[model samples]
Structures are given as C-alpha cells and as structure tokens.
Target: MPVHRPGTARREHHAAGVLLAVLSALALLLTLPGAAQSADGENVPPRGSARMGQGVLEHDGQGGEPRGGDAVQTEGVDVSSHQGNVNWSALWSSGVRWAYVKATEATSYRNPYFAQQYNGSYNIGMIRGTYHFATPDTSSGAAQANYFVDNGGAWSRDGKTLPGALDIEWNPYGAACFGKSPSAMVSWIRDFLTTYKARTGRDAVIYTATSWWKQCTGNYSGFGSTNPLWIARYDVSPGELPAGWGFHTMWQYTSSGPIVGDHNKFNGAYDRIQALANG
Candidate 1:
C-alpha cells in the first residue's frame, strides 16, 4: 500500500526477471525503518517472499542481505503470490511476528497463493491476516469488500487471527485518485469499511499513505477511530497521520524490510501486538 511518488515503484520492484537482478546487484541491506539496532551486532536477512506495493516483491532466489537489527520486537510483512514460495521458518527466525497475505485485488483477482501464504504464516506461529487491494473505480466499495471477504477476508476470533486490511493505496493504473472525486472517494471507502465491519464484527484496518489519502479522499477524517490506520511510507520518518487520525495503529516502514512485500510494525510493543493476535 505504498505511494507511487517516484522511486516508489516501477524500476524498484517486481516479481521476476530484471528488477530482481537490479535489487540483488544493489546489494541493499534489509531492515524495517526505525527498527532498533542490535547491541550484539547481529545481522538480519530479508525474508524471502514477494511484496506487492506500487509493484510486487522480487522472485526469491538470493539469500538475505545483512542489515542492522537485533530481533524485531513486533515486525510484520505483507505478501502476494508474486513473492513465490515463502520460507516461513526463516521468516519467523528473523523475528516476523505477524503477516498480512494478499487475498483479493479489486473484485476478480485472487492471489494464486492465498491459502499457502495465509496458512503458512499461521502454521509458523505468526499472527496472520489478509488484505485486499481496493479498486473503487471498477465497482462500489461494498462490492469489492464482499468479494474479498468471500475469497479470504473472513475472520474468526481465532487467537492468532488479525482483522482484514483494506489496501486502498495508489491506483496502479488510471487516474491518481482512482478517477473518483474526493467526496466520492471518501464515500466509497466508508462503504467498504462499513460492509467489512458488518461481516467481520470488527473494523478492518485501512492501509494508505498520507499523501495518497489526502489527494484521493480530500483527507477525509471520519474513519479515524472506527478503522485503525495502517500507514505506508518508505525511507522517511513517519509523517503526519491521515486526516483525523490522532494516532496510528500500524506503520509500514519499508518495502525492503527483512521480508518481501511491505515490512511493518505495530505502534506499540510486543505485548500490544500480542494482545492483538490473541483477539
């Protein structure tokens, strides 16, 4: 759910072929943004999975690059089928405590690897959730949300389950705001959240970057409390929250995190995330 503001997508990330070669050649170190440094100077490797942002994660072939971090206290990763086969054991060993696997995008495309990635993360003792890439322009938000829930967004009070996330970021295609006016965008988003809440008995997490939110939804502020915010911003300090949010629930710190896709963290400590997982 990262913004596509130059260097945000395109040449940087993809599932196969040339982009991976470029990333590997760069030999970039992997770590979550603002993750605590290790006192023992231990090295952490990037998790081998595909991450979908402005694009998707690289195909797994290379080993993890060294980065500065001890064990992440409450780190998470999001992945789509593009990530290929995930080494969940390796990911857990690297301190990932939760995962959000891509389930459905818009109303039609289901991730080919949804069951494997979703069940894979849970089997490894990670709190697991699913997300949907929203396409407001294609249909009503409720339509897409229902499609997502039917596919994979359904949740139980399973101790290790997390609420579904609504990945309403930059439209990969079409107008920047997904072709809707600001007010229409806001209405569409609310429709999705409301529908998701009714279905899940819990509010869905809203994933978006600050600027994209502002531009698309006129910086709408109505959802601050009902829907927890999952802010995605890479390579910079956490910026102002989306309109009306007094605090953030989750922060996607980097796409180049210890694993593929987007690397993220809860705003609080392990205990808090533990509380989330148990619920």
Candidate 2:
C-alpha cells in the first residue's frame, strides 16, 4: 500500500496552484492589445520603422515580370526613409518615370527623406506623389488623413504631383488586420477615403495586396469606382485583385528590382501617368 503523506499532498497542491496562476497570467497577457507573439512563441513589439511594402515583402516573396502581357506600361518606384537620398538620376536613366514617396504613418511618423525623395523625383521629370501608411488601430481615419495632409499627402494640379496613396497592408507591428473586424476595417477605410477626398478634392490611391484586402476587408469593392488601386503582387502576374476593382492602376511587380526601391508599373503608358498626376 502506498502511503500518502499529508505534507506532500499540501506541497503538491500549492505547486499546482502556482503553475495554474502563471499560465492564467500568460494567457491574459497574450490577449492584451498590441501583444504579438512570434512563430517561436516570443513576444515581439511592433516595428517603428515600418515602410511602404514592408508587409508585402514580408508576406509575399520577391521577383516577377510585370503583368498585362507586353502592354505599354510606365515604370515607377516607391521609396521610404529606408532608401535614403535616392539616386533619382540613376532611376530616371533606368527608364523609371513615376515615383511614390512615403509621407506620414498613422499621424505619428513622417518620412525624414520626404522632401528629397519627393522633389528629386519631380525634378528628374518623374511624376511623383506621396503615400501614407495606414494604422487604423492607432487613430481615427479622418485624424490620420488630416495628419497626412498637413505633413505631405496634399494633392496639387502641378501636372507632376500625383494624388497621395494610402498604403494599407498587413500590420508589421501586431495583428494582421489591426485587430479590427471586416466591417470595422471597411468603415475605417471609407472614413479615410472620404476625408482624403474632402481635404484634397481627389480620391486617394489605395495600395494593397489582394490577399490582405480579402482577409481584412472581406473583399470590399466600394472604392473601386473612385480610388485608383495600386496592387502589390510579386509573381509572374498580378494574380487576382480585390473586389470592385476591374483593373489595377499600379502594380508593384518586384521588391528586388535593380534599383533602390520597389519597382512598380503604371498600368498604362507615360501619358496616362501624366494624366493621373494632372488630375
């Protein structure tokens, strides 16, 4: 017969209670907002230097030919503070025509190299525009839009200044969809678009990946008629677009182009790019 000691039982119960308490605390921590766990189960904070296409490059692999099967397309590139002091002359010499510079993010971050990248592209005769990295989890879309406009996302009829683009993709910091449900995400986007148009009188361009769009926004299509879509897909072709968009206005074909930043394609010829800027 096995003899059960009273003290042993009491000690075992106390140890089990401690273990359970620890586990419960861990579970609660994981449920907290901005709590992110890596694949190896390590907690990781959000990256502060999130740039244009950072999520796309992280989720989607690089390398691909431009889609549209040999159709006429104007080349472009998108840059952030990562590509400090871009060599605009070299990109211009490489047949690049249009550029998008990272402007503001979540109303908190403004690209330090915005002036150089934005003006250098324009000075090099490239139709250049700005983009705002959306962080719907941090602030209201309208507030972020106002912040973007005040910083560098304003539009002009200079015939070389393209309307700003809203770069909404996977959250590099925490939850992929910023912890919002599909409908809530859609509403946030609508608010941003509405406010952007009100501030600039131009429908802002939307830069997104189809997979992220479908997963986050439930494949919302309401913006297709107004916002120009800048689709990011690094493959032999732009696989499939999100709902409502009949065609992509811009396609980011490759992240590892022979240039400084991610290379993209304006869906039409150089004249179309100029037309978009002129608008």
Candidate 3:
C-alpha cells in the first residue's frame, strides 16, 4: 500500500473488439491526454483507459529522453521490476525526492538488492523513502508484511519506513495464480496492513494499477479513511483520477524516462507530488 489514496467492470457479451477498443482508448487518453482533448470537447483516446494526465512517461524507440529534478517538481520511479542494478547517484542527481523500492515478494522471494540499495540510498540522503511488496496469489498477507518489516532496512526509529506500500497488480502468474476473490484479497491486504501498522505505528499505503481496481477491487470498502493510495495509470498525461479513493499520495504516471547513469531507461513523475504526498 502507498500513502496516496488510489477502480470497474464488464458485461456478459462477446465484445473483444469493443473491449480492446475501450482499453486502447483508455490507454491513449492516459498516455496522451493533452493531444486527445480538443476544442470540440471530444477525447481521441478509447473508453475505459482515458483520463491521461501530464507527467506520463514516454519512450523514444531507441531510448528515452532523460528527465531529472528541476525547480519545478519531484521525480521518482518504481524499481520493483527493476533489478538493483540502477545507478543511485544518477537518480539522486536527477532530482529524485523519493524512491519506492521493491523490497520483498510474498514470503519466499526478495529483491536481491533491497538490503544493499535501500540502505545505500538512505545513507546518502534521498529525501523520504519507502518499500512495496510484490503480493503473491496465495493468501499470506501477514508473511508479506513481515518480510517488508524484517528486510526492508529503511525505517524510522518508530518502526515503519517513511511510507510503506502494497503493490497489488494483475496476476501475471496465469489462472492458478488468479486472485482468491476481491473480498478475500481485501481481507488479506487489510491483515497485512494492520500487521504493518502495529509494528511501525503508521498507516500502510496501497499501490495499484487503474485497470485492476476498475475490474477487480474497485468496490473494496473495509479499510479505514487514513490509509493512503498510490496509483499507476500510464497515459498521455496524469488526468482523471479515481473517485472511490478518498485520499491519494502519489501517482506513477510514466514508465520510461531518461535518468542519469542508468544502464536502461527509467520512470519519472511531476515535482508538485510532495503536496499530494503531504510531506
């Protein structure tokens, strides 16, 4: 879970084209909101994925344009999928105010570089920092929380990291890896969050993609209002935010960007995010 607060559905019909069109439109709107919105008030992107906003990342085919810190805003990215092979100094030089590093996955797997990279960055002073877990399909929210607490080296003397996150994305593990049900998932997540809160004495945050929420966990209603949300919607811009979430702290709007000294491309976001994070 993330500090920012971060939903949808379908009918019983054979509408593959319609579904693709809808998702495509949404992606376009999300990736290119400025281009799509016109004087006629008609968005060019498809349906379900529209609402792109500024700060959305872009790729230039061969490579991406490097974007770092400016007097204008904060910059950050998701390093969960990214192996610990990043150049921390490049990001620091690029004006990275925060970092959401992937620390653990469920109970068995851990980010090989979490311990080294997390502490490495913290020691060097990278503003605020946090960790997110790669949730597994099986129900083991407590174990996941424990993994983060135990291994996530970055934390305040009080216990929790400056912020903590739950990276709940679509189950890419196939059908068997499918969810246990929205309610069950919510229960599991709540359990993990509560466990973390008890240990750290801070509210846990949830990070998720927009489509996952819309189709799967949009209606989840058990958590308290204090929980924050961190959402990921890669569109043309960072437009149309989710409504169900009462609070949101961060928005991961881009997936590709130019950062200093990194072997591969990276992601970035707007500078005004500190306001959104309330930091």
Candidate 3 deviant stretches above 4 angstroms:
1-73, 157-161, 221-224, 260-279
TM-score ranking from best candidate downward:
2, 1, 3
The clash number for model 1 is 6
Model 3 error, position 120 (Å): 2.7
lDDT per residue, candidate 3, 194-237, as tens digits? 88887777677676655555455555655537666676655433
Q: What is the lDDT of residue 51 in candidate 3?
A: 18
What is the TM-score of each predicted model, taking all chains together?
A: 0.74, 0.84, 0.62
Please identify which of the two predictions, 1 or 3, would achieve the higher TM-score against the true structure. 1
Clash count of each predicted structure: 6, 0, 40
As a TM-score, model 3 comes out at 0.62
Candidate 1 Cα lDDT to native: 0.75
Q: Per-residue lDDT of 32-128 in model 1, one digit per residue for the tens? A: 5222234354432222221345522221112233243453446789888777678889889988888899888877778888888998999999888
